[model samples]
Target: MDKILETDGERLLVAVRNLLEAKGLVTTAEITERRAITDAANPGQGARMVAKAWTDPAYRVAMLSDGAKAAEALGIPMRGMPPLGVLENTAELHNLVVCTLCSCYPRAVLGYPPFWFKSAAYRARAVRDPRGLLAEWGTHLPEAMKLRVVDSTADYRWMVLPMRPAGTEGWSEEKLASIVREGDMIGVTIPAA
Candidate 1:
């Protein structure tokens, strides 16, 4: 019989879960439930938050100061995890999230990151050649625009609050949220007007 093998990351994840389960720290049922929670959290959550920020002055302030609290206010469950820092992209600057060491992210907001985000090539180039990388990703900023590459560590997960596109004023929150996709919140792309 040919035995299928798991990838390095899968193996490591299983090992860690096993270690915790053996120590009575966490059970398989709890792990399964957490996985369910993460799976349900897609980029739409981020988009809704962005839409709220675009329309509501008070919620925007709360989200910027306390991302987790703001998310909780919207019924998004976030606990026992590192703080989720919301980075606002303005006309003068752009913000990008990358984990130089590992794939740390706000899973409760952005769901599982894209496959490319976990690649070593992307991790290295996000800091070394951000402009080139963004261009390749179809996000061309103005010449010499200020770009901030935020590293998402285990202590803090970063998400981008993309600037509201022009001509989107007076739009409903659902409409605005529809246009803001996952990559936009990740700062690799801009939402269409």
Candidate 2:
């Protein structure tokens, strides 16, 4: 049989997993089931929460108060995951999220973090020159608006609740959800209606 090479990180992961299984701490079936649940999560789950918050005041309050619970209420699994925090953007304040040390993201809601999100350049620019970073992504905010950059860490994750675009009034939840892109939830871009 041909030899299959693996990176050190990959080898370490395999070793740890094997040890865990050997010790009966976790089973392969359980691991596969958990992986499947995480794999099934997508940006759409976050969009649904944003849409519901846009149309429902109660939901908006709930989402802002407890993001993980709000997601659970919407049938998105949050168990065994770090606590999720929702950053609400307003007319006067804009929120941006970045994992400065690592790519710690709300995977349960936003699925996987984008490649750029994990880049050292992005991590640095987001904190050092947020406005410039936003401009590069075609997201320009007014001069008077305050830009707040929040960091996601292993202990906690964050997602943005972007402001509902104008002219989207009276739109249904599904319609609103359709316009919410992953970038919007990541605070890299604003949703356009």
The TM-score leader among the candidates is: 2
Error in Å for residue 62 of model 2: 1.4
- Please give the distance, in angstroms, between residue 111's alpha carbon in candidate 1 and its true position after superposition: 0.7
Q: What is the TM-score of each candidate against the true structure?
A: 0.85, 0.87
What is every candidate's alpha-carbon RMSD to the true fold? 4.2, 3.8
Tens digits of lDDT, candidate 1, 65-95? 9898989888888877578889999989999
- Model 2 alpha-carbon miss at residue 71, Å: 0.9
lDDT digits (tens) for residues 82-192 of candidate 2: 899999999999999999998998889999888989999899999899999999898889999999999775687899999999999899999999999888998999999
lDDT of 2 at 22: 99
Score residue 59 of candidate 2 by CA lDDT. Answer: 99
In model 2, residue pairs whose N, Cα or C atoms come closer than 3 Å (at least 3 residues apart or on different chains), thus clashing, are none
